[model samples]
Target: MSLYTFAKNLVAVILFPVFRIKIIGKENIPKEGPVIICSNHTSNFDPPVVGITSPRDIYFMAKGELFEKRFLGKLLLKIHAFPVKRGMKDRNALRRGLEILEEGYTLGLFPEGTRSKTGELGRPLAGAGFFALRSKATIVPCAIIGPYQPGKRLKVVYGKPMDMEKLRNSKASAQEAADAIMEEIKFLKENHSP
Candidate 1:
């Protein structure tokens, strides 16, 4: 198996038992073509949870600090994680994201830009919306619920692919697309039961 697959499977083996992950709406993931998996950030565990549950491989833009450690950086890179300097507009990272989509790969993004301290949805960064508009990729909003308590169920709900055509034609701002995506995620989180 590729390192990405091995790592994803390894993570699933380690976390699934402890977290009892429950996935809903996985079918919403497109079988082929470019896709953008947008979700809220709560814990560091969110990425792995979403990655393992997703049907396709996911490329993520992690914080640049994560790559500061040599070993961890290489390992993360091997497993499809790239570094991005957070809190500012990093053009390289944005370009890389668009490239991934152009190549028809899945790009995973936490629209909030960072983890929420109170486990509440935060305003989405314009990056997510930019990717959707620029690449015109299928955007899927995901909501992850429940804490990382051992033996406690962690639920991940994937919403339907958003229709961006209207927004694209309306000459909507990236922030507007980001807001709409967040609204869908909020809906899933509030309505989907654990």
Candidate 2:
């Protein structure tokens, strides 16, 4: 394993139980190959919460500002994260995501684009769907449910992968596909509310 993987795993082992994280449906993840993990954004902690609970290394797209700090940016890179512009189409980020998939790695995306301040599910952005369509990768819908309080236990639910082939061939637009994915996440969130 890469040093980054080891470091992340160590941190997860150390903190997840302390945070009372409860992960479900880990077996739903494919054992290998490129997979897209599309999840809801409830808090700033959601990324690490999902990432640490996952069985494999998951690369995520952060905003460009996160990477502007040299030290923190270097650390993020080591942890397999790259940056995308917040309000604009970031071609570079798109390319990096495709490259990660092409390299047979898992990629995590919050289709809602940003964290939900009120902890309500937001309309999903089309980036995740577009990536799935372009890369022909399987999309695993995930939901993280809980308040971000230190002592509260969090729940993570993983849904079955969406049928990308059907999505690709159907009349559904990219945004439609993204919405469908978000709907699945919403269902899981409500059902598995912590």
Candidate 3:
């Protein structure tokens, strides 16, 4: 097995039970395809949590800052995470994201761009929609409810993939598309139980 999967599984085995992670709508994930896993960013743990709970291997677009650290950067890179420059267009990151999808790999991104210090949903950036529409990849909305307090029960609900074909055809702004995705996550938080 790949190092990332091995590490992810090991971590899940240890943490999933301790946290009592509740995963819902897992069957909604596609068996195989290029897709974007979109969710609100509440904590750094969100990435590994999603990685473990997902039915398939998923790569992530982490902030560029993480990659600047020597040891941490190597670790993250080994685990399938590449860096993206926040608050500005990072062409290199965008190209990498497109390349990942083109290779039919699942790409994970937080629409909010950065983690919410207060654990509240923040205004989403349009990066997720940009990548999704540009690649025409299915957008799977995920809701990670509650702060990532260790050993506390937390829920992750994956909503069915949104209709990207329709979204692609419509003349919607990037923000509008992002808003739609956020709406899906919010709906899951309110309606779905994990």
Best by TM-score: 1
Model 1 CA lDDT for position 6: 87
Please provide TM-scores, in order, for all candidate models, with all chains considered together: 0.97, 0.93, 0.93
Comparing 1 and 3 on lDDT, the stronger one: 1
Error of 3 at 128 (Å): 0.7
Q: What's the lDDT for all of these models?
A: 0.94, 0.86, 0.86
Off by over 4 Å in 3: none
Candidate 1: regions farther than 4 A off: none
Q: How many clashes (backbone N, Cα, C below 3 Å) per candidate?
A: 0, 0, 0
- Per residue, candidate 1 scores C-alpha lDDT tens digits across 129-177 of 8998899699999999998899998999999999999999999999999
Which pairs of residues have clashing backbones in candidate 1?
A: none
Backbone clash pairs in model 3 (N, Cα, C under 3 Å; residues 3+ apart or in different chains), count: 0
By lDDT: ranked, best first: 1, 3, 2
Over the stretch 86-105, how does candidate 2's per-residue lDDT look in tens digits?
A: 89989999999999999999
Report the lDDT of model 1 for residue 46.
90
Tens-digit lDDT track of model 3 for 9-124? 89899879877899988888898889889987787788989999998889898889988989999999899999988778999999999999999989998898888888767888
